[model samples]
Target: MSEHGGDRARAEAWLGQDPDPETRAELRALLDDPAALADRFGAKLEFGTAGLRGELGAGPNRMNRVTVMRAAAGLASVLTSRDDLRESSGGVSVVIGYDARHKSDVFAEDSAAVLTGAGVTVHLMPRPLPTPVLAYAVRHLGCAAGIMVTASHNPPRDNGYKVYWEDGAQIIPPLDQEISTAIDAVGRVDELPRGTDWRVLDEAVVEAYLRSLARLPLGTARDLTAAYTPLHGVGGAVLAQAFAWCGFPEPDVVAEQAAPDPDFPTVAFPNPEEPGAMDLALALGKGRDLVIANDPDADRCAVAAGGRMLTGDEVGGLLAEYVLRHTDGSDRLVATTIVSSSLLRAIAAEHGVRYAETLTGFKWIMKAGTDRDRLVYGYEEALGYSVGGDDGVPVHDKDGIGTALMVAAMAASAKESGGTLLDLLDDQARRYGLHATAQLSVRVEDLSVIADAMARLRESPPGELAGRTVTEVDDLAEGLDGLPPADVVRLRLSDGGRVIVRPSGTEPKLKCYLEVVVPVTSSPEEARTRATGDLTALREAVADALGL
Candidate 1:
């Protein structure tokens, strides 16, 4: 059969099997369009190291009810086989949560049904909630597994399913691969069992999550009058309540993006990292102490204070210092992703704490922390932070709501010290030297184009970047410092500048992260000029290497 014909056949089979008329009609519509069919059924959605994520549509390659059910079945199988999990939970149990994205609830339900049919007990959250809450629920409820349906900050058309183990962290290594194997074992959706015994989650579980937020160290309620925006995602209710629980004054909501809307009508993309995602919040926050925002799924956070929005690196730096100062001992360990700013390392070193750098994801950091009990905090450059120890507090996963509350507490404490967050940042720079980080992304319509660019750069590496000699080249794909292999390349410059080039695992773009360090005595004007010049040179070299 022709490729298009095969696609049509597959889509038609799905439509015929679908019980929902609405979904069947949508699938049929795609069947008639060659391009749509190819996009939908070109391949089965691969469960990568990051779990399952893709555009929502009626194809094997998409994140639809059928695909979600398959993933859940696979996860259930993995959970059932684990002796430790079975003994703890009595039976294999999985907690599922979802966001307000299109079809997210339906997908979550589908996963629950699949797990139920597999003889695994299922607890479904009563309504859409933050990703962190689901992460917390996994450990709090003592379930064998957990699932969250969200695309996080991806575009409106996208959705995802992330699986977490009993520890409330995203599945890592052997488990991820084992689940993928089980998912691949089932050849047809009809082969899976169907059941209806999945239970709606207990109200107490969610209540407990809220109660935990109340214990964070906010100094006083009077010092926190802030602005908040959920970016038309699922964070509003949980985050607002968390702030209130922490004794923070009610925040002024950005009316436009206050509610959970799958379409994300007010923003181009539901990501706080995107330009203009915080415009409404910034406008509404004019006179407030700070502006806090969460992405679609509420797993990441962004903060703006004193009329300036801080980058993820800036926030990470501040949080790292705050957590360190709060700790009494010097034996703490601080961890960050390799792509993040190295200023945290300087702070750790100054405090006589150990600093560790993981590969690019929070999963690695979480695992590293689990292996070492000394870990106090871990953060990535993408606005994800795990405060306290990996096994403590809300969850091991990245949590925006919890982090925001902590920020409020820090702000309140800073006020008591007769200074501001900016003042603390300045002090950090004075002690650690000045470290500034920036990233440049090159977008492309076709993913293969990015693959070609990576191939070209690897075949012929650049000798210099931004007029600085490349002092060393570390091909992460070959393994670095006893770490697992990853698809990344790091270029160390002769000056205290470095560049990291890697393709985004979850998106269709190439990312270039640049970090430059200047003496603390240098004026801000001089430091910025030097960084900009270095960035421009690096950009040119990247373009040349990619032949773009």
Candidate 2:
């Protein structure tokens, strides 16, 4: 048989046992089209960085019922295999949560059935909620693990399933591999045992999470007007209620993008970092004091304050300054990704705080914080932040709702004290050399393009950025600074200029992080001007090296 013919035969056999009527019908329709069939059944999806995320469709390569079932059973196998869990009377408990994305609820229910049938204790969230809520419940419920059915800020056509260890952080390294091996061992869906017995959690979990948000405020929250948009996500209603409970004025909401809509009709991309994603909120905040936005799953936060949208780095600096000033940040461990601006390290050093740099993603950043009070803050360049995650299980991940509330309180206090988030940023720049950051991301249809680019750069590394000879090239693949090996390159140029390039873990894009910090020799304004120019030049040089 031809390769395509073999694909058809395997797909037909698989379809005979597929329990989902939707997917079975979809496969049947594609049987007449060999190319579509080949594309769907070409290869099974490999769970990679950020768990099992892919376009939603009817084949193994896509996010469908069969793939998710195997993933759930795989995770269940790992959970039940633990000696401690198996010894327990009730076995290990697993909390499951879902966001208001396409088929997210279905996937969550599917996971519950598989885990329960596997004799694992399963508790499903009462309804669709943010991903962080699920992360918090893992430890809050004394469960051995947690599973969240969400694609986060991915496009409308995509969905994902992520497994979190007892630490409340996503599974990393050898464990993900173990789960993948178990998934490969899954038998036919019709033959698998799927019990209907499972627990649907009450509102106590949600209420307990609110108590943590309530403690996030430090200074006085004065009269402040704000606009909030969840970008047609699940964060709106809960955030509004939290604001009401926290004694803040009702925010002006972007009605069009306020509801939970899986279609995401309002924005091209559901992420606030994307251009035009915050347009509605900005327009609504034209005369307000602040504008806040959360992505689809609400695990990330984005804020526009004092009429200017703040970058994740700037927010990181301000939040660091705030948390440190309020608590003993000196003894605490604050962390940001290596690709993020170095301004944070300067801020930490100036205040006598211990700072650490991890590889991109919260899985690495979450480890930066140790005890509840000792290790305090974690953030990434991409709008992910964890302010109150010091306490275990409750918040082991980045949370948009809590961060947004904190931003509102910060804005109010700033307004009362005659300062803005933008002013605070300028102050930070003046204190710790004017640090400027920018990014250049290239999206591609074929992921091999990214792999080829990284390989080429590794083989023939660039020696300079914007005519400045690089002082050092830290090939992250070899694991420098006691960190896990990652496919990244860090180039240190003359002055405090730096450039780091890596393929994005979640998307099919090659991302480059650029930064240049110039001393405030004469004036802060002058330093900003020079640093911006240097960053622009740095981007061009890196783009040229990448052959973009």
TM-score of each: 0.93, 0.96
Q: In every candidate, how many clashes are there? A: 0, 1
Q: How well is each residue in 365-464 modelled by candidate 2, as lDDT tens digits?
A: 8877445436677889888888853342238789898788777777788888887778877788778888789998999999888888888888888877
Candidate with best TM-score = 2
Clashing pairs in 1: none
Q: All predictions: root-mean-square deviation over Cα?
A: 2.3, 1.9
lDDT of 1 by residue, 382-442 (tens): 9898776222445677889888887877777777787667666667666776687888788
As a TM-score, model 1 comes out at 0.93
Q: Report the CA-based lDDT of candidate 1 relative to the real structure.
A: 0.81
Q: What C-alpha lDDT, on a 0 to 100 scale, does residue 367 get in candidate 1?
A: 71
Give, for candidate 2, the lowest lDDT window spanning 10 residues: 387-396
